[model samples]
Target: MHIIQFEGSSIIPISILTTIASSLVGWIQVKRYSELSASYILTAHEIGVIKEQASYVSSESDFSSFIRDAETAFSREHTQWIARRVANRKPK
Candidate 1:
């Protein structure tokens, strides 16, 4: 760790406070990362399920309908991602 400049002799409390703030920031980042990872995993799992359902369609019309629904779901997910990104940006 770098030596922090203390104007007077009150270095102990400042150093402890700095450490606590850094730890809190790190914890927040880890929580956000886990949440994002879960989101991606869930989206991928949904795609797999959609594919399985689409595979069971015996007619072209049914397959087309399934594809349309999958596209709509993907679009909605994209929109949600964009909204989240924007909201996060606004705070920062």
Candidate 2:
């Protein structure tokens, strides 16, 4: 570990830098970026599946079913996102 002293040895530059870096990382986690990322990836995968199904559709019923499934997937993702936000808002 390397440390630089400043202000007549009253301040440690290395410790201050470390604290700032950790605070930034903590802020990112607190913002739920990881959960948001996972949600997007999963939603994209679900949409890709729906897209593949779309190509095989040959009738109105099949198209309707695909639309329903796609809507359900979107709603599920949205609900999860809302749940995450609500969870963050609750007293902890």
On lDDT, the candidate that comes out on top is 2
Model 1: residue 40 alpha-carbon error in angstroms: 1.1
Model 1 quality (TM-score) = 0.72
After superposing candidate 1, which stretches have Cα over 4 Å from the reference?
A: 1-12, 90-92
What does the lDDT read for residue 65 in candidate 1?
A: 85
Each prediction's whole-model lDDT (CA) = 0.82, 0.87
Quickly count the clashes in candidate 2: 0
lDDT tens digits by residue: candidate 1, 8-84: 75445566778899999999999989978887888898898898897689999988989887997798779879987
Model 2, stretches more than 4 Å misplaced? 1-31, 90-92
Against the hidden reference, what TM-scores do the models get?
A: 0.72, 0.62
Query: Model 2: per-residue lDDT, tens digit, 1-92?
Result: 67787667665668789999999989989777777888899999999999899898899998898899999999999899889888779685
lDDT agreement of model 2 with the native: 0.87
